[model samples]
Target: MTKLAEMQCEACQVGAPQVSDEELANLIKMIPDWAVVVRDGVMQLERVFKFKNFKLAMAFTNALADLAETDFHHPGILTEWGKVTVTWWSHSVKGLHQNDFIMAAKTDELLISGK
Candidate 1:
């Protein structure tokens, strides 16, 4: 199977079907560090990336912003002194979509690439 990081995101529309339980089970394996969270009754994929200091955390935040622009998908990001919390979900669908998984994998890649 192709790695999620290597996959591209598809345009998500309102009413798009959220991932099924089986699909979530499989996809979650690829991003084991991420947590599936429900906020306001919507499922979201979330993870926290740690950094050395505020500067590094901000750098990663900027890089992630660029990546989101490139993918045309955005995530809720909270940058702190030593870590950044990223939450990915399809706002259009108001739930978790495959795009969330794809972006989560890509976000992990940013760390692996030393962003």
Candidate 2:
């Protein structure tokens, strides 16, 4: 089976179908560390990675920023002194998508690669 991080994000249109219950269940397994959240009534995927120092945190953030630009799907990223919180959701679809899960997995991949 193709991993979530290995799946490329397709262009999500305004009326694209969000990941359904079954899909969410499967994708959730692919990215177990991510927490499903509802903010302003829209579903999202979030995870926070702990770091030992500010420099490492910023490095991860910068890497994610570049990845977001490359993927054309940006995320809500907060880089703090010892942690980076990443929130991924499809603003166009007004909820989570397969892309969100894919990006979330990719984020984790980047974190591990950086270490």
Candidate 3:
């Protein structure tokens, strides 16, 4: 199977299917650093990336923005002094989708690539 980071996100529509429990189990393993969280009754994939300082955090946030723009799938980003919390979910489906996992893996790649 193709790695999540190598997979391109497909256009998600309002009736798109959410990831199944089996798929979520497998995908979550690929992004172990991220947590499966429920906020306001919505299931989301979230992770807090640490940086040395505010500047670094902002830089990472900007890089993530570029990725989101390219995929046309945005995340909820909380940037702070030394950390950035990213939350991925498919608003169109009102739940978690494969794109969220793909983006989460790519987000991890940003750190690995030192973006």
Candidate of highest lDDT: 3
Per-residue lDDT tens digits of candidate 3, residues 1-115?
6999999999999999999999999999999999999988889999999999999999999999999999999999999999999999999998899999999999999999987
Point out where model 1 deviates above 4 Å: none
Each prediction's Cα RMSD? 0.7, 1.0, 0.6
Better of 1 and 2 by TM-score: 1
TM-score of 3: 0.98
Predicted model with the maximum TM-score: 3
Residue 42 in candidate 1 has what lDDT? 93
CA shift of 39, model 1, Å: 0.5
Pairs of colliding residues, candidate 2? none
Tens-place lDDT per residue, model 1, 2-71, is 9999999998888889999999999999999999999999999999988889999999999999999999
What C-alpha lDDT do the candidate models reach, one value each?
0.94, 0.93, 0.97
The order by descending lDDT is: 3, 1, 2
Candidate 2 deviant stretches above 4 angstroms: none
